[model samples]
Target: MTRALPSGIGLMPVRRPDDHRPRLDRLSAVPITDLARRFSAATPTSARDLDRLDGDLMLRGFAPVGTGVLRRILSRPSFFWMGKSFRRVDDELIAGHNFFTALGGSRGLPFAATIGPSVVDGRPAVRIDYGDPRLAGPRLTRRLYDELREIEPGLWLGPGFLRIGQRRVTVCWFAVDSSVGYGEVR
Candidate 1:
């Protein structure tokens, strides 16, 4: 008979963050390659994880590599975007929208996206794609694709890519945490 080791025995004692804030801080300070490696190693966000994240998801933006001071500053919260709100539209598609705090937290520039399964770094991932004109506005904005992996329970990490002339370039690194509250967008 096969036997399983008791809990915490014959297993790696990996220390994980109690919350996403400290974890995000650590990821933001690491080299971009290290962050990508972590993302690559993380598990793909499962349907159960998305179901648990069906409300307003908090966001933390990390500056891309080689960016100047201003870009790094703008990557911080409340500067570029606040967070994203997600709702299950169908059995396989989750409708999503982004919110900003520019005018006292008004939900303006309401672009749309869909979170679905996709491949990233030759592995499975939950990709937020804005390629549908009906969902996302403007061709330029539609070229953005962000793939997410579940780093920890209720915490996800992803790299945002912008397609430019058939080439995808990494624009920024971001984290989505379902553990925090940021006032749902109406």
Candidate 2:
């Protein structure tokens, strides 16, 4: 059975490498546009899989949604965001927050969200919504939306969007690597 892609983005042509570390490294070196395209080609993951990623302290990698030097700069660690932590809140939704390496320790931020199954860009994905007043901050954080797809055994990728009135603006591209931790980046 062949399904149509949503135009522009297409399936990633290269076969995924066997070793996750090399795969992650190769992905990290690709252009942001390629990352987004690869994400579209990836498989949608379940909340149970995400919950299993808990306690692993997923390593974070990101790229800006735009082109040029700033995009590359932001992708590099400036200590703004470290990684994310996931926990199952119920059968359907998974609760998690961004954990930053700050103040001499891991500082989990209040930019939390609930993860669940959803359709994004015409394909199945796991969504992260920060709309709950109790989970996310009442202001800007509430406008943030994200989604993820599994690219490898323990690697996932997604885009972060900011809701502006009726428009959802793509702000950045992010990845969570469950295969590695804070102390294991090489």
Per-prediction backbone clash count: 0, 0
Task: Please give the lDDT score at residue 14 for candidate 2.
Answer: 16
- Write candidate 2's Cα lDDT for 31-66 as tens digits: 887888888888766546656556324444655645
TM-score of every candidate relative to the true structure: 0.75, 0.72
Lowest lDDT 10-residue stretch of candidate 1: 4-13
TM-score of 1: 0.75
User: Per-residue alpha-carbon lDDT of model 1 for 1-186, expressed as tens digits?
Assistant: 432111111122212222335655555577777778889888755555566556556677876767768446744544557566666655555666665555445432223333455545666677777664445266677788787887888788888888888887888888877776543233
Residue 129 C-alpha lDDT in model 1 = 71
Clash pairs detected, candidate 1: none
Q: Looking at model 2, which ten-residue stretch has the lowest summed lDDT? A: 5-14
For residue 183, give model 1's deviation from the true position in Å. 5.6
